[model samples]
Target: MAVRQVIFAALGVSVLALGACSGDGDPILMHAGAQNRGPDEFAILPTKPLELPDDLAALPAPNPGGANRVDPQPRADVARALGGNPAAAVSPGAMDGGIVNYASRFGRNADIRAQLAAEDLAHRQRNRGRLLERVFAVNVYHSAYEHMWLDKYSELERWRRAGARTPSAPPRELLDN
Candidate 1:
């Protein structure tokens, strides 16, 4: 009876250990986004929204590590206007709205994540995940691996200078090959 009980206990512990390692992600490829969240450095934080670029070809060259052209950062300007610190305004603070209630002044981005996830499902359907990504549930790591780190603004300038239908570069994998 004592031997039988010890066997059962050992089996249970082994099962638990295996269960811990058998998660959705591959341990070798899953370390991105694990650091402390910080302010986006490459983002262009204009004090106000950009007007339509009359001469589309004359804008500054976009960085590979930058945000898109149209992300609206209206709060920084608003906070400066209202005599509040722009840094304090920009940093997330639910209860620290200096001039007006945050809820009253701004629409909460609480549901924005869920909305983006829903759109991402549609995007995945269109783009189609690779076999390894689908099998190992490596969406995050796969995105990091597959990202095209190009300077869109510089690419636009290159195209403008060519003054012809310049052929686009092939995907990174082709270059690797």
Candidate 2:
């Protein structure tokens, strides 16, 4: 009876050890919810409207590498829509001095974008799922970030209870859906 009890205890301990080895906690996903799909439809831009030239011989020589007269100029279009000089869109220095000053008030890091991209890649790789999850190519991004998920309605209620005003927040009843 004593020998049998010892065997059972050892078996239980081994089972727990195996279970612990099954995974590292909080699995991350490499691409989040990204799916393999066709090219984005919004990326295709329409060419500028066609217009007949005043003189056939007066037309400038075509340079494939250079900007075309009929090329879509979205910045110019936006400037025109806002009743500003369309030509201003071509000049980098045409931006308002006050706006530029305010935007650069905090010191800028030129390589910040590259640094962030590298750091994000490292984080995803470091937390990239368990052995079985990685082997089966399972997505665990949402589950991994579950702690960061916000319940907006509950948060608003808590804030209101604490006497904080939320003028633009929707009613709690509307947030049920």
Task: Give the winner by TM-score.
Answer: 2
How many Å off is the CA of 39 in candidate 2? 5.5
**TM-score, one value per model:** 0.24, 0.52
lDDT of 1 at 127: 59
Q: What does candidate 1's lDDT look like per residue over 1-177, in tens digits?
A: 999999999999898667655665434434554433454577755544567988888988878878554655467668878999866765556546664464557656668899998986776576556775555454454454356568665676577577756358554355446
> Candidate 1 at residue 59, lDDT?
83
Instruction: Estimate the TM-score for candidate 2.
Output: 0.52
**Residue range with the least summed lDDT across 10 consecutive positions in model 1:** 26-35
Pairs that collide in candidate 2 are: none
